[model samples]
Target: MIIPILYTFYLSFFDWNLIAPTKEFVGLKNYIEVFTDPVNQKVILNTLIYIIFLVILNFVIPYFISLIVKFFISKMQGTYKVLFFIPSLFSLVVGAMIFTWILNPVSGPLAYILKAIGLTMPNWSNSGILAITVICLITNWKVFGYNFILLLTGLGSIPKNIIDAARIDGIPKWRLVWNVILPMNRGIAIYVLILTIVQGLQYVFTPINVITTGGPYYGSSNVIYQTYLNAFVLYKTGTSSALAITTFLIFLILLFLEIKFVESRDKDYV
Candidate 1:
């Protein structure tokens, strides 16, 4: 890991190509180009968008859903868990392909249902925002259950004595959840948040690749996909290395902040 990362960092300072034998030392030129390139700027923006939506849909929504499923539907919780988690068993390519069929505006079942209801289906694959939204939805559908199960495990780890004590103190149900359960699960919550922040962009890459290929004028192109395009598609090894290093630095800072601010607070709660 260290060797490859160091090598990539070294390569980022030079003009290199995978196919070409010759290499040129550019000394920050690749990094400069990455920052100034218009498409890369858009790719960064799309990455931020992907991270925001992925965290919200995959982590936050699943956390709340798990809470509800664990508390309200305690009897059928096993069935619900199985149903929600089934999608996570599929590979990313398969999941993306499934959603691509579902979102097909012309011949998909979604279009058929809309037509039956006398409504027009929008072209999901060609529209930028809609395409990203579809990617988020599909990605969430595939992974939300996994997160849900993690949160459920977190909930289970909370001691029954703590909950019983809270109830005996006459805490209302909602207040009990807000004050006791949520606090007790802070460790797992922070874990989920940090994991999402770190891996969110990578998770969205597959659907974008399979469904839209960052289409609608590169609207959904994220940092990871852009790096892939740069290295493999465009054969700009140095530029790709620079982009990867930049992304790694950004996420490293984020992870530090999470550990410093969020995890520190979790310690207090725990």
Candidate 2:
């Protein structure tokens, strides 16, 4: 793990094709190019957009849905769990392909249904926002369910005594959940939050590969996907390495913040 990452970092300062016997050192030029390249800039922006969408669809939505299912739903919670989780059982490839067929602006069922109402489906593939949204939708189908289950487990893990005491004191359901449940659930909540950001930004890789190939001009690509494009498709090893290292540092910072936040919260959590 460490070796490849270190090698990639070392390789970032040089220009090398994977096949080349000679590495030409061009210290920090690749990193400079990555920052200045219009495509890389867009890809980075797209990744940030992906994070925002994923946080909403996969993180915030699932957290609340888990809360609702766990607390409010009084019956057949098992069935709901199974229904939500079934999508996660399939691979992203399957989900992407399924959505591809379902959402195809031409000749897709959605298009056909819209046509029946004298309406036309917008060409999502031609637009950046819609393309990314489609990718997010495909990813959300799989991720939302998994996050829901994980969060549901966290909510379940809350000490029953705390909940019981809150209830005995005639705490309103909303107040009990807001004042008591949310704080204790933070441990798992933050884990899911970070996982959501990680998966939220990265999980669209398969859908993007299949649906857009990061097109209408890299409209749907994230950092991970862009790195793969540079390394394998473009065969620019140095640039890819720079991208890899840049992404690593960014995520490393996120991991550090998560640890610090959790540690401080644990101390303050009672």
- Top candidate on TM-score is 2
Give candidate 2 regions above 4 Å deviation.
263-270
Q: lDDT per model, in order?
A: 0.86, 0.88
Off by over 4 Å in 1: 254-270
Mind giving the per-residue lDDT tens digits that candidate 2 earns over 30-121?
99988899999999899889988888899898888888888888478778789998999999999988888988889899999999999999
Q: What does candidate 1's lDDT look like per residue over 1-270, in tens digits? A: 999999999999988778778899999899998879999888888877888888899898999888888776677888878999999888888888888888788999999999999998999777777888888888888888888888999998889998888889998989999988998788788778777767667888888888788887899888898899888888899999999999999889878877876678767766
Each model's number of backbone clashes? 0, 0
TM-score of each: 0.91, 0.94
Screening candidate 2 with a backbone cut-off below 3 angstroms (N, C-alpha, C), the clashing residue pairs are none
